[model samples]
Each structure stands twice: as structure tokens, then as C-alpha cells.
Target chain A: MSRSFSTSERRVLGALHYLGFGLFLAACTAGFVRTWVLFGNPPSIDPLASHRQYIQLLDRKQDYESAVDRIEIAQQLAPYTAAVDGLSIQGYGQIGLGLLERGHPSTARLYLQRLFLALEQTTELPSDDAEMLDMLARILDRSYELGTGAEAILKDSLLLSLLNNLAWIRATHRSDSIRNAEQALRFASRAADMTKREDPSLLDTLAAAYAEAGRWQEARQTERLAVAQAERAGVADVAISSMKQRLSLYEDRLPYRE
Target chain B: MSQADASHFSVTRLTGRSFIHPLFDYLVIGGGISLIATIVIWQSGRSDIVPMAVVPLILLLSNSAHFAASTVRLYTKRGSFEALPFLTMAFPCVCLLLIALCLAWPLRLGMNLQSLYLTWSPYHYAAQAYGLAVMYAYRSGCLLTTSDKRLLFWCAMIPFLRMFFCIQDTVLGADIGLAWIAPSSLYRLFEPYQAGLDRMLLIAACAAPLVLLIKTWRSSSGAIPMISLLMLVTNTVWFFALEPINAFVWATVFHGLQYLAIVVIFHVRDRLSEPTNRHGKLYHALWFYGWCVLLAYALFFCLPQAYQMLGFGVDESVWVVIAAINVHHFIVDGYIWRLKKGDSNRQVVDSSAPAAAPRVSSPAGL
Candidate 1:
């Protein structure tokens, strides 16, 4: 079935392939350097998609390891992407709580520390799901409404996260509709107690909740303690400065709102 | 469908069994260029020698070109517009609607669509490799027994299997590696199992093809064609040897070359088989490729720019459109290349002319 070909036809065909290859290669090269190099190729937008999708899904699935892996990648790919960093903040908080529940406090602290630094940097919660904060608020409100006790409604880690995250949101969110000082105090006190106040970040959240409730005396005292705890624990200088700034605000009888 | 129309095509081709020339097919379409370039890059140990723009350039030339080639061929093949009504008439609308949905719901639909494309990419590459290998074998008058066919199929699949393992374990371990949609728990729990399995998969990726070759050699007493073997090895090396980031760039380009080569061959063949085609192979090849380039530019560049004009971010406009284009190509290829009786693709398999004597041997139930 092999068809015979003239020698010249074979040469022509082979030459044609070379020509095609050369032309395409030349076109791409010229197009790339002249146009794309001047303008830039489409920025790889992997993290833009990864921000909302991977971290939230993995965290919800309680796949902490994979969530951490994705968080690391997203962070590496787009360092300042608020959505990704915010998702990482939430992811790390959940992962730390999960690890602690599994009796890995040392590992838990590692993730919690990352969450702490990330939270201190961001002025607002940029977690991919904008409704997530509302969801946390809803969960907390429902738990309180259940009358059976918030502790009974959520697992230990979930309860702690709901308390910490919602308290932070209520105490510092710019929207007055979401802020409720008394509720913030209630959530923060429970979180402080749950962490035994040893965690400086939780203490700071409790202090912010205190400032929101207009209890300037307790706010100053709590913030002073938070600042001390933060410094004693060798927290980052930027965070210590932030805590100190909040301390000053309470000293001036001002409530912090981000 | 009629005698006069059927008579236009000469028996398979008027040349030796290899599509175009054996040298042309083997070197350009057979993964030879990719293999050589990869070896050179690795041996040089200086990946940076190539500018970063080369990535996009390669994508434009090879990746984008080959993808457009399928669509161009589908539309240009005489009677295809009549044969594939949905594909020609309505399927583009389907693709357009899908793109709009993805654009409107970037998170819900767009991410899923993007992930689908990412996950399907490697599988598509492997499938094309397997396809081209088999087509080359058919064209070259190589007879593959049933067992031989099965062996070749699995051997070709080693690349996918290797990728599957590297991702963590299962397919959907189909990693969170090349695949965008893998569960974390499977990827993590299997972490301990991964190292051992990777070694096994690596061994298998390398060894399985050799076994297939030896077995086929013993059974059929015919050596597997060099092009087929090259395809098997190139796919394996593409996933394993090249750095993952670089692999994405080079593999697509090389695979693009392979696709463009065969698609050009088929396209020219189809054109020439038309009794009315007054042009020679070179003219037809250039015309087809030129259209592919134009379409590629329009699809990849201008469409994205148009989306940007409509207030989409450059990211979604470019990537989502790219993803949609790929899914369209993949789906179209799945249909256009089916080799059934009375199918245009039957000519691709049949070595003789349309009514030229019976095929010396069809690939089992090809």
C-alpha cells in the first residue's frame, strides 16, 4: 500500500514543511518581541481564581493540609492580592484551630501566627466570600438565640473561630449596621476564656471588642495588657505598634473602627 | 457519498506510506523537534537563555495555531458544513453562550470552566499523541494486532498515569497537579503513599512502553514504528523531565507542532482529494496555516481585547476565552476525527484510495 513518490516531490514536500515552520517561528518571534514584549503577555491570573476557589473550598472541606498548600501558593503567586491574603488569614485561623483540636498546639501556633500577622496587616476582611462575615455573624446570632448555649451548637474550633472572627468584625467593621459593641464584648470574652488569654492575638481581639463597647477603662487596661502580651511574646514590631496605637485610641476614649 | 466524488482521492496518497515525507512527518509531526530542544535545554542547564516572552510566543505559534487548525479544517473540509450541522451551525453558538455564562459568573461558572480546561489539557495531549501515533502506523502500513493495540493504548497512557500520581493519587488525585479540581484530603492522606507510588509510576512510565515494545516485537515480529515510539517517549519526558512551568510552555509548543503537522497533512490531503482543487499542496498548506494564524490571533488576542473593551479584566477576557476555545477544540476534535465507515476520517485510516482495494489491516475495530 506504500505509494511511490518522485524524488523531487519528496524534496518539495519536505521543503514546504521547513518553510511553514520557518514562517510560523518567524511570525511568533516577531509578534512576541515587537508587540508582546512591549505590552506584556496576559498576566497569569491563577491566583485571581485561586483566591476565592481553592482556599475557601479546602477550608470548608476541613482539608487543612491542602488549604495550607494552596494558601502558600496563592501567597507566593500574588503576594498583595487582598482576596488571597484574606482567604489565607481565614484559612490559617481555621487550620490552627483544627490542629489544636487534634492536639498539635505547636503546629497550631505556627498557623495561628501566620493568621495573626495577616490580620494585623489588613484593614478590612477581604475573604473571597463577601457573605462569609455575614455567615459568621448569622452563626453567632443563631447560637445565641438557640438558648442551649453557643458551645453546644458548634464544635470547639468552630465556636472559637465564630467568636473570634465575628467579634473582630463587629468591633472594627466600618459598617455601623454590622457593629454591636455589647455583642462584640460577649463574643470576645468567651474567646479570651477559651484561649485562656495566653494567646496574645485573641487578647488583642478581646481588647478591640472592649474598646467598641465604650468601656474606656477596661479598653485601656485590656489594650495595655494586649500590648504587653504582644511584646513579651516577641510579636512583630508592626503589630506591636498597631496594638500600641489602639491602646492610645482607648486612652483617648476612642473606639477603633476599620 | 457518490462514485465521482469518491474517485477524486488517489489510493491513500501518491507517495510512500508516511504522510507527506517520512523525514517531514517524523521530525516535525513526530515530536522530534520537541525532543531535541528539550534535550538541548536540559543539557545546557540554562533555561533562562530563552526570554520569558518565548512562553507566550510559543503559545501563540504552536498552541494557538494547532487549536485553530482543527476548527479551520472542520469548516474547510468539503461537505463538513453539511455533514456536521450542529458543529458548524449551532455549536459555535453553544460555545459563545458558555463563554458568556462563564464571564458573567466568574466565580461560580468561570472557575469551574477554567478548571475543566486545565484538567482536560494533559488528557487531550495524551489522546492526540495516541491518535497521531496510530494514524501514522495506519498510514505507514503497520498492522497492529488487538493485543498490540491494547498495549499501545496503555503505553500512551503512561504520561497521564504519571501525572495522576504526581498530583497525589486519584484522578479527581488527578492532583490539585495538572488538575485544578482535586480534593485536599486525598492529596494529603496519600502523601505518605505518594513517594513510593511516584517511584513506581516513574518506573512504570519508563518501563511499560519498553515492555509493550518487546511484547509487540515478539508477537507481531514487527518493530513499532519510530514515530509511535517517539510519541510515547516525548509525552513521558514532557511531564517528567521539563520543569513544570517550563513543561507547560514547551510541551504545548511541541505538541502543537505535532498537531499542526498532521492537521496540515490531512487538510492538504482533503483539499487535494477535491476534484475541483486547482492548487498544489504548498498553496493549500499555506492557505490553511495562514487562516489558522489569523484565526488564532483573532481568537487569542482580539477577542480578549474586545472583552476588555466590554469592561472585563484582562485576566478573565484572556484566560476564560482561551479556556473556551480549548474546550471547543477538544469537543470538535472528538467528533471530527471519528473513524467510522462512510466517515471522511475513514480515508485517514484506509491506506488505499476511497474505493481502492480493501485496507491491508485496520487497527482492530478502529
Candidate 2:
């Protein structure tokens, strides 16, 4: 029951099929060459910018591995240039944060360590931009708090915020394996000394560190002092209340765990 | 019409008996059960296992193989080149290339191009569904009157209208690239109407098939093929039943498979009829499908890797190629399936002339 087609009709259909195949081959070839020629090489004057652009594209696509690889290339290409260092730090930080959010703490720690190493290599950063260094230090400290790594090579000059974060982490880390009462006490005392015990948040960290070390009387006294200072400084009432609750915990000889 | 006459209007009538069996038709064309099965499997918690396993393969076939098949009908034939004109073909390719270059250059216009593509995609899906529905209807011998055709077209269009007015903001608005092009004024204008429009379109889309069914019943001799009704229903499910991302994934896969099935059937039937000497070796259906799979792999997977190795941005290049192919497919499909009086029309549908008899053999003959 097959319908007969004229020879011309068969020829036309066959030609159409071949034409389609040919177009596909042509398009694929053209696209491959066009993309390669256009995006393959780094820009002559701005290789760093080109690498940054490629890294951004990879980040958007969530290809963390390729983004990391691009970061490495950019780092090698420019070494200590502020722009390349900034791009690498941002790229690695993004991948690290993304992995952390996806519950891959160990993998996230590796990226965060890479970010810190990149930050350290940029020694020529303007001395006036202390805030940028402080922000990066805080980020690195937070990453350390999240998972194990990079604890051995501490920054030479730690910002007050980094000290407070590290002190808090050691004082109240939920895992017994991570908590270090002695290190928490050291960081808390140094941070408090630098702030002259004026920052209520620093005093709060000191209280937590005292509690972590089983110094209940000192912990209770520090918590009370923190609450009074916070109230005088017009900290949120909720904060003052939370400080009081911590004082009560110290009064009962119980350590704060967060 | 008698049962014998009704049988003449089936999918088996158009595709040779060797190619189409009832089970195959039901699975591919009567796609309601397929949608239901996918939904059930997806929701079963173990859905991840299957989708994770099958989705990549489906993507290759759907995005590359199915998309590439349209080229056959558009550019291969001598008439197609003349009909399309060289300038018309070059324009889109050049435009897409420009868009890709803009994106690579990190320009704002690339964002606009992306927004436009996303906005246009649902309509493309709807148009394909409508075309397929009409095709099935014609094959099944449903003598659709003018009003019936209009109704069927609107039915196909309703989902896209809903998508455009209501769900578009949620899907595309959050995208930074899309937001660059989407004016705040348009959002303000459409925001209030979105809810009402969505509900109305949902109701209309749901009810249109029933209306079609009733019209088929009232037309005395005309019968509504189950496949036609299923197609409309499946389109509704694709738009409404799943979340936007999931809907995009599942619908694309199903739609791709559907297109592939039909195109393969068309290719096989036409090739078998052609003189073997001119065509070289005659391909078995399986062998033809294998070739399609190889082409898909080369295009979707291998090409991107090659670009990546050459230092082109892999993800961007892959996305650009995919977007380019899609834009080309939509444009090509616009005219390829037009029911004109010629061998093309006769090959797909039975001739309405009284002098012509149904030459298609029954399924048992194969």
C-alpha cells in the first residue's frame, strides 16, 4: 500500500535531507571557529580583564572548577597586580561561599584558603585601604570557623573583628573537637586589650571564652559588664537581653555553645 | 463513516505499517500517559535517580538531534533555498553571532538578546504543540471546519498567553540579564492583571479540549483522535503542573522526543520510497536513529569541549550555540510544515479528492 513518488520528488526530498546535514556541519564548524578565534586568546592589553570576564562567566554557570582554574591563570599572568589579585580573591570567595552553602565544608575550606593565599600575595595594596584588608581577614577567619584548614599560618596583623570572630568560634564552636578554650582566651584578651574593653561585643567574646575555660565567676562578671556597656552604648535591647541570658548561663556554670 | 473508513484516518494510515504500531502511537503521540508517568516518577522521591541518569541523554537528543532535524526540511531541498532566499538565512545567523559576540564582549545588549530568547521560547513550544495537534487531527481524519481550526489554534495559544501575561515575570524578571531589558513600567502595568489573566487562561486552556471534543461529536462523521485531545491536555500539564524550571526541563525533553519521533518517521518513510541507487545505501530505521544520536553527541557534547580546549569560554560558547540553534529552529519550523498541495502534503496526509483511494496498508501487513 506504499504510495509511489515521482523520481523528481524523491530527488527533492533527498536533497533536502542532505542540505540539512550540510547546514548542521557548516553551522557547527563556523560556530567552533568563531568562538575559538573570538574568545580563545587573552586580550593584548588587558589579559587580566579578559580572564576576569571568563571567570565571571564560569561563576555564573556554576562551574567552580573552571573558575578556579581561570583564577590561577589570572594570578600567574599578572602575579601581584591589584586588579588580578582582587579578581582572584572575589572568584575564589564566590566558589568557596557557594560550596559552603551547598554543604561541602571541606571543599569550601580549600577555596577559602586559596582566597587567603591570594590576598596575602597582594603586598602592594594601598596602605590607606585598611578596610579592604580588614574585610578579607574577617572573611578568612569566618571560613576557618566553618571548617578546618589554614589555621597554622595566621595573618601577622589581625584586625579586631577577626580576633573577635576567632575568639567567638573557639569559645562556642558546637563541636568539642573544634573548640579551643586556651586559644579563645588568648584571642579574647588581646581583642579586649586592643579595644580597651570599650566594645561590648568584645567583652561578650571574653565572657564566652571565660565560660569555655570553666572560670564561672570571671565569666559571670564579664557578662554583667558586657550587658551594662551594651545598654550604655545604646545597643539593641534584644542584645542586652541576650547578654543577660549568657550571664545567667555563666552563673549556673554552664558554657555557651554556638 | 464506517469503521473501515475511520481506520483509514489513523496514524497507521500516514506512516507505513512497518513504522507505526498502536502501542508506539499511543506512547509517542497520545502523550497524556507519558506526562502522567513522568510526573509520578518525578514526584516519587526516587525521581532524582532517573532524571539525573536520563536527563543528560535526553538533552543531547532534544537540544541537538531534534533541533538539527528541522534543517532537513528547511535548507536541504532545492526549493527551500529559493523560497527562503539567501539574505533571509544569513540575517538570523549574523544576528545570533552578533548577540554571541556581545555576550562575550560583556555588553548590555547581550542581556537583551537573552531576555528576548527566554520570552520567545514558550511561544515556540506552544506553536509546535499546535502544529502537532493539527497534524494529528488531519491524520486521524478530523475534518476541522474553519471555526474548529481557529478554536484549536487558540487552545494551543492559551498556555503561551498565560505564560506571557502572568508567569513571565517570575521566571525572567529575577534574571539580571532579563531585568536589564524588562522595563519597570511594563511590570507595573501587568502586575495587577497577572492573577486574573492567569486564572482565566488556566480555565480556558483546560476547557478548550472539551469544547473540541464536543465539536467533534457534533460534526456527525468527524471523530476526534485521542492523540489530538491528549496533545492539548499535555500542553496544559507542561505549563501548569510543574514549577517553571522543572516544567522547562521535562517539557523540553518530552517535546524533543515527540519531534524526534515524528521527524524520524518522516525521514524513514521518505527515504524508503526514494530510489536506493541515488540515495546510496538504504538505511534501516535503527541505523538512521544511530546516526542522529552520533550527530547529537558531536554537536552538543564534543563541540563544546573542543571550544573549551581552544580557550573559548566553554559555558558561554555552549549557551550561545544552543541559543543560536533554537532561534534557527523556530524560524525554520514556521514554514516547513505548511500543508501545501504537492508531494509534501500528500506524503503526510490522505488526499481529499474523491478519485484518490487510500493506498496505505493495514498494520498487520508489515
RMSD of each candidate relative to the true structure: 14.5, 12.9
CAPRI-style quality class for the chain A–B interface of candidate 1 = incorrect
Instruction: Please tell me how candidate 2 rates in CAPRI terms.
Output: incorrect
Across A189-209, the per-residue lDDT of candidate 1 in tens digits comes to 988898888777778888899
Candidate 1: stretches off by over 4 Å: A1-258, B1-17, B168-182, B348-366
Q: How well does candidate 1 score on lDDT at residue B32?
A: 77
Clashing pairs in 1: A3-B15, B11-B353, B170-B173, B170-B174, B171-B174
Please name the candidate that would achieve the greatest lDDT relative to the true structure: 1
Residue B131 displacement (Å), model 2: 1.8
Query: Which tens-of-lDDT digit does each residue in B16-129 have in candidate 2?
Result: 222266567656754655586567855773435354445555566655567666664454433554455432344344544463574464224444444456556667777777
Q: Chain A TM-score of model 2 versus the true structure? A: 0.47
TM-score of chain B of each: 0.85, 0.79
> TM-scores of all models?
0.56, 0.60
* Candidate DockQ scores, in order: 0.02, 0.06
Instruction: Report lDDT (CA) for all predictions.
Output: 0.64, 0.60
TM-score of 1: 0.56
Report the C-alpha displacement of residue B321, candidate 2, in angstroms. Answer: 2.5
